[model samples]
Target: MNDADKKRLLREMIFYRRFEDRTFEAYMERKIGGFLHLYSGQEAVATGVLEKAVVGQGNKNDYVITGYRDHVHALKTGAPAKEVMAELYGKETGSSRGRGGSMHIFDPTQNFMGGYALVGQPFPLAAGLAMGCKHKKTNQIAICFLGDGANNQGTFHETMNMAKIWNLPVLFVCENNGYAIGTHIDRSTAVRDQYKRVAAYDMEASQHDGMDIDIVMEAAEKAIDFVRSGKGPYFLEFMTYRFRGHSMSDAKSYRTREEELEWEKRDPINIYSKRLIDAGLITQDDIKAMEREIDENMENEIIKFAEESPEPRVEDLTKYVLDDNPDPRWIGPLQK
Candidate 1:
């Protein structure tokens, strides 16, 4: 990558870090509601992969979907920070018009379908989207992001089988953060190696260090290339970590502080910043100025946008509950 590309990647990683940091603070201060999941430690995985997949590197028509830890993905997909923050705040100006809250951020224009709150739900949805692209004869592919825990779901296995049999254009990315809520992967899953599980379907699968952006970008480019070439589906497992608790209400008694600190030492932002400095792509002063600008933008602009945004009215509570135009045969008894 060129110096400009490196700088852009750095800026994006830093923006996500700051955005997630500020979001946690906002949640604590009661500025945001719903079950909040901060993508603090896993920034590099999303940044490296999405930056290469969506931004300039890959096809613009590609679809991106993920589980509830979706703020970073939404931002990387070109969603405005102010509107995303407003969504978390449950305001009328949110991406989902304040109804979906933090879990269900959807913007079809940007090709970010929606963040599924249910574990492993995106697996089938992604396959279905890929089928649409295949039927339409479009070069578009669907990138499905899920947690390691979700891999154990029956839907995940079913989708994998379908993708392999039908040769769907989908990339299944498992963000293996070591733990699924309070239960560790060992306790919950029979097979710890997620990538190995794909061998049964004869699909291409590999694992990479999620903390390194360059590594992620490389893997993502290869995976995307293969899928787009109509070689069927591919699976990638990112060995990443999540610094924060599963949710805002997590007591965090499951993991040790020492383990957390050890992972903190390998923080993606710090690692990438150091690489940029050592490679002469960026200076300490440059990084400081970039951080300062991001802080100002978040505090002065984005936060205010969410704060001043109007709340959704009670009368319109059921507005998006059902379809705007329903088929007569499909209409339910309640509607009749």
Candidate 2:
């Protein structure tokens, strides 16, 4: 990539980090409604994988499906910042028209299938999409993302086996963020190494240092290449950690403050920024300017959409209930 392209990728990653920080603040202030999952510590994994996937594809034809801890992915996949914020705010102009809220932001236009709230639902859904693409002779690959917790689901096993057997175009990525809600990875699985989980299905899976953007980028490129070259389904497990609690209401007693601070030292943004500066790819002033610019842009959009966007009318509740027959005005005009 050229300097301009590199800078754009860096800036995009910064925007996701800063936007997520603001979303956390919004959750605390009671602006964002429902469950809020923060992706602060695992920025590099999403940022890095997305850069190559979107860049290499040349556009948004490729698909992405992931679990509820998905705001960052949604934003990076081309969903508008204001619309994402509004979706959290439960406004009508949201990506799902205020229906899905924070957990289920879907933008088919951007090829983002669904920000599925159910822990393991998207695994099979993603495989099915990949199968469809294969049958249709489309070159587009479906990047299915899941958490460590979701990997243990029955659907995950079935999907992996079937994807490999049928030779579907799918990249299975697990963001192993150490803990499943309040439970640690050790307690959840006998084998804490998530990449090894795919061994049963005879699929290609590997672990990578997800805190470093370059490391993740290299691994992700190989995974994508494998799938595109007719390797069927590939699995990638990213060893990462989340800075915030499981949700806005989490008491967070499962993890210690010292542990949190320790992970903070490996903060993806800080690590990447230092690497860029040390390598002379970017300067300290450049980083500062980038942050400021992203912050300003996000703030402006947050206010613009949240305050200006209207909520869907309660009388129109029955509209868009089914895929086959969508009712634009199901409830009709409200009676006086």
**After aligning candidate 1 to the native by TM-score, how far in Å is the CA of 309 from where it should be?**
1.1
lDDT of candidates 1 onward, in order: 0.89, 0.84
lDDT (10s digit) by residue, model 1, range 117-159: 8987999999999999899988889989899989888998899
Q: Which tens-of-lDDT digit does each residue in 30-149 have in candidate 2?
A: 888788887778888887887778622324467888999888888777777788888888899998889998899888778888888888899999998888888878777889888899
TM-score of predicted model 2?
0.93
- The whole-model C-alpha lDDT of candidate 1 against the native structure comes to 0.89
How much is 61 displaced in model 2, in angstroms? Answer: 2.0
What ranges in model 2 sit over 4 Å off? 55-60, 323-336
Which residue pairs overlap in candidate 2's backbone? none
Residue range with the least summed lDDT across 10 consecutive positions in model 2:
52-61
Candidate 1 regions exceeding 4 Å error are 55-59, 325-336
The TM-score of candidate 1 is 0.95
